[model samples]
Target chain A: MPKVTYRQHDGSEETLEVRAGTSLMLGALTGGVEGIEAECGGSCMCATCHVYVDEAWLDKLPKVQVLEDEMLDDTASERKPNSRLSCQIEMSDALDGIVVELPESQI
Target chain B: MATDEAAGLVVIGGSHAGHQVAIAARAAGFEGPVTVLSDERELPYQRPPLSKAYLMGKQPREALLFRPAAFYEEQGIDLRLGVSATAIDRAAHTVTCDNGTVLSYRKLVIATGTRVRPLTVPGSDLVGVHYIRTLADIDAMLAELDRVKSVVVIGGGFIGLEGAAALKTMGRDVAVVELADRLMTRGVGKTVSTFYADHHRSQGVDVRLSTGVERLEGENGQVTGVILSGGETLPADMVIVGIGVLPNQEIAEEAGVDCANGIIVDENTQTSDPDILAVGDCAQFEGRFYDGSLRLESVQNATDQARTAGATVSGEKKPYDSAPWFWSDQFDLKLQMTGITVGYDTEVIRGDVAAGEFSVFYFKGDTWLGTDTVNQPANHIASRRLLDAGYALSQAEAADEGLALKELVKAARKGG
Candidate 1:
């Protein structure tokens, strides 16, 4: 199992051991880590699962797709340079201990 | 309030809305025993993919679940799958289940959703005829797919077209029979409908419009072909019907809940009986976006309404005001719509429609109605935000493909 830390907008953090194959959005949802609404259920159709990856792990994460880049423009919160749709990020051993910060809102 | 201690929150239906109600209630700090009763044996799953990804075998059954099975236990939600609420006793604040179990609730949320309207034509009950409404329906259809060489899909709604597309992708001969003059007349505009019909035809699907299935021809109780109104017989190894759906509001209606086409709910999602609330496809809510009460059958409606109902149950009364949105994945095209496109007198097309990447911005005079975007996600999201903010783009601006919709949304927000 690989662990992922979810940092809330209020500066609180919660870490959970997510299954290797699950996406970060599902991991946060199953672990009850707040702030990831995942309205589209990992389809990348809704940008509600937007999260800012930790700067340290930004280079290691998978590159954003064109659709994701387009959807990032519509996030309810400001889209930082490291902003990515959590549903698009699949958890793996290489990406273990990755930290992602939640936005203020995901409407 | 004697029963309040033992009676927590009871939710009926395990679809999107019902599942969301439980999760949202817990998230809203409702510290009582939350129980969800679902007629389905499997955990609550996504219905949208049933005719697309799931039908194409791209997504497995596990992937269809809204949440992992263990998540319910962790949330203290007693998810009762394979059980259904047979009746609701409003006087006693109790629900009687088909399994002969009785459950009491402080607040009851009815998310019974809707069922497929059965095709009453002859041979409709043949073995090869199917309806795509549940996981079981898709699974059964999948089991027969290997043997099916040709399929005739009745109705031109989202389900029928998506199914036809999936079947065609699977190398099966598919024909879509629509009684209406255009495809998806109930949801999308004529332009969108025409585009889809043409697209399906280009993809080798026999798109039949203004054609009616007078009767089904069957061999040994299995559907073999469809007899058209003009006395033409189209051979089919299987038949899929997706005409429409009817809300499952029998229990609510029996309990004297105000009912029309669906269970009536206010902005707070509270039904006629204050103790009971209804959401999703089974709920007809007083319109905030359109005039008169409206019933929407989409994941967005279910999820948003459930959230509002959860808040109301937790004593946080937030009105249901989210703009309704829907999406469909057919072949390689992703169609996303925001707001209601009804009563639109004018439509603005952005991008290249010939290249299959464009959006139709519908407007009734100066009022913005909604937009239907194809292969354009940014426009879809921006349209939703614009509608939610009660802002409309000028006709000229919407027609200008050079202008990005996101920038316009930002400009609108800043202008306010």
Candidate 2:
């Protein structure tokens, strides 16, 4: 299991010990962590699950796909270099202790 | 009120809107008992993936669930699966289910989504013919996957095309037969329909436009081919039909709820009785986006209305006036659309369709109507925002590729 930390817009954090093979969006959603609307049900169709990954953990995650890259530009929060659609990121034991900050809104 | 028979909130249908009503009711601090009546045996799952990722094996069955099985119990929402509400007792405010369980509710949300409109042609009930609506439908279709070599899809709608793409992706021969001259005519614009038809053709899918199926040719109770209206027969081991869907508004209508094409609801999703509310495909709502009273059959519409209706049941009343947005995936092209493309005077193409990255902007005179984006997600998102804000972009300004739509919207907001 990997502990994924979801930081709210108000600087609060809720860490969940997520099982491997679950998506970051699903992990946050199933754990009842607020701020991830995931309107498309983790299908990568909607950008409602946008999250800013911690700068240090960027390379550890998989490379961003072109669709995700385009979706990142449409996030409610300003698109930083670390922005990624959390649905596109699969969680695993190898990527434990990953930290993601939720945007101000997922509209 | 009888506490045992009566509930605080009850949601009919178990798909997107029904599930959303339950979740939203709980989220809105509705402390009373919440129950969701789902006719399907399985828990609430995403229907969009059943045609694409699930069919292509990119994702498994468990991945289709909107939430884990335990989430409902944890949220204190009672999920009565494999049981359907047989009748609605408006006077008593109770719903009778198939299992002889009569549950009363303080507030009733009718999210009984549409069922598949069965093909009525001869031999339509053959074993090899299928309609894509539920998880069970996909599972039955999946059983014939290994032996199926050539598949004839009966409609060029989203489900039919997505099935064709998924079958093609899995190394099978596929063909689409659409009675209309173009693909997705009822849902999208003519240009988009043509683009998708060409896109499918380029992918080796035999896109047959203006073709109709007269009958299904079957052997030993199994479909083997399709007889066309043009007096030609196409050999196919499997057949999938996706013509369209009708609203499952019978339950509400029978209860004397005002119904035309569907159960009519006010902007608050309240029915004529006020105690009963309707949302999703079975709901007809008046709006400025479409030409007349609209009964949208998209997940986005269902979930949005469900949220509004759910919130209302929980003591918060918000008008459901959000712009409609929808998405579809087929053969590497992601199509995203916003607003309803009705009564548009001019359509502007923004990018190169040949290259597969383009957008079509629809406008009525100077009023921007909607946009259809293919493989351009940024445009899709921005289009939703612009449509939601009621900001209109002129055809000329939108046609110019140098202009950024988001920046234009921002400038307009600042000027205001």
Candidate 3:
């Protein structure tokens, strides 16, 4: 299992051990990290799983696609250069010890 | 509640609302622990199927479940199914479960949603009297369908009517009884409802309107017949009730949140307590801003409200302003509706109702209020767009059945 560290807005951290071949959204889910809702399951119909890939590990994940890009643009959170839908990011050994930041709002 | 980094989030339900809240919390950049408490053992699921696709047995369990196991694991969500929140402590911000475990949270989302309103008349607890709400209900209904050749549905609402239609298509002697004056009286206009009722009766369903059921009569603890309010008795081996639902807002009310018919929230889905939010059929918001001060019941409302709620959890204060929409599938017919049709003074029936491809367009004065389309997805799609875009329709163009909606609206515009 790879360890994923989630950095909170107020300078705190909650780490979860995630198995490879899972999504960052799932890692956050089973690990009990806060603030990822994934409303439409993983259908990409809803953008509740929005997250920001840590600046350092941004290149390690797959590129965001057109649908995800479209959804991210609709997210209430301001899209940053590092914004990504966590559901689409499959965890892997290459992404071990990665970090993702949460936006101030999701509505 | 203080913004303590150690305070975890605990969502007490596991379907549309619960799943969305967890994901949206993470999306909004919250940094703490998150846990989903669910009673059902199955993974979180899309529930629209329980009445349609799942009832027909065409959709598998995987098709209805939310996401795969790995999605939860990788998202770092602690999904504790087979668990339920038994009580709440507002001061401590903790939820006590039946298993004697207590989970603490900085903020809480009460997404308990709703349970199907049960039939409350005499013999309601009989073996053959059923209410179609959950997967278990459908499974029980499907099993009984094979042993019986006739069914008398006790309600004429959407679920009761759809169940009657589905069983009728299966070649059973199906009968529908409604206390209302027409089928889907709460949904469509009188004209459209009449047309649909005529169609159902023509298809061999005993469509009984203005009828109220008194009790389910039985022999040896099983259903045998129904006694109506008019003192008329009808024979049947099975009965399905679709009386509608009540919002599951007791928990929110007890937790000190403002709860009316549902958990009262604003357009942003924010409850009065600030620390709690409600969504789905369990939520009630501002009144008469669109319709006659009403709350809605549908899948579109659930998913859309979930999005708005999720966004709120993400820390944004966006109001839920998306136009409401809903769909229902019947035997060889698809009914799509948009907006609130309560205040329409004039309705123009486009195309031929006899041919079954027309739409009922409702307008209040000059503005388009809403529309109901039967078997015309394209027309419904166009109507939803035009209604949502705030386009007005002239009485002449709206009354003219020969003119296409596009051309009619274009010609009736201010400049034209």
Q: In every candidate, what fraction of the native interface contacts is reproduced? A: 0.38, 0.35, 0.06
TM-score-based ranking, best first? 2, 1, 3
Better of 2 and 3 by TM-score: 2
Tell me the tens digit of each residue's lDDT in model 1 across B114-188. Answer: 999999999999999999999999999989988999999999999999999999999999999999999988678
> Between 1 and 3, whose DockQ is larger?
1
iRMSD, per candidate, in listed order: 2.4, 2.3, 7.2
Q: Candidate 3: TM-score?
A: 0.76
**How would you encode candidate 2's per-residue C-alpha lDDT over B1-416 as one tens digit per residue?**
33365467989988999999888888888878999999999989889989998888877787787777778888899998999998899998898898888888999999998978889999898888988999899999898889999999999998899999999889889999999899988667877898999988888999999999999998999889999999899999999999999899999988999988889999889998898999999999898787689898888898889889888898898779888988889988889888988677688898888898999999877788899999887787778777777776778888889988878767766776
**Candidate 1 Cα errors over 4 Å, as ranges:** A1-22, A27-35, A60-62, A91-105, B1-5
Return the TM-score for each candidate structure: 0.93, 0.94, 0.76
Q: Relative to the true structure, how large is the alpha-carbon lDDT of every model?
A: 0.90, 0.88, 0.75
Residue-wise C-alpha lDDT for candidate 3, range B1-416, written one tens digit per residue: 33323567777788777876787677667567878888878788777667666777655555466666777777678888889888777888787877888777777777788888888888888888888776668878888878888789988888887788778877889899989898887788877889889888889999889989888899999989989999998898988888888988877777787777888888777788776777777888764327534567776577666667666766776567666666666677767777788767888788789997778888778766778888765556556545545666566666676666655334444444
Q: For model 3 chain B, give the 10-residue run with minimal summed lDDT.
A: B407-416
What DockQ does each prediction reach against the true complex?
0.46, 0.49, 0.07
Instruction: Report, for all candidates in order, the number of backbone clashes.
Output: 0, 0, 40
RMSD of 2: 2.2
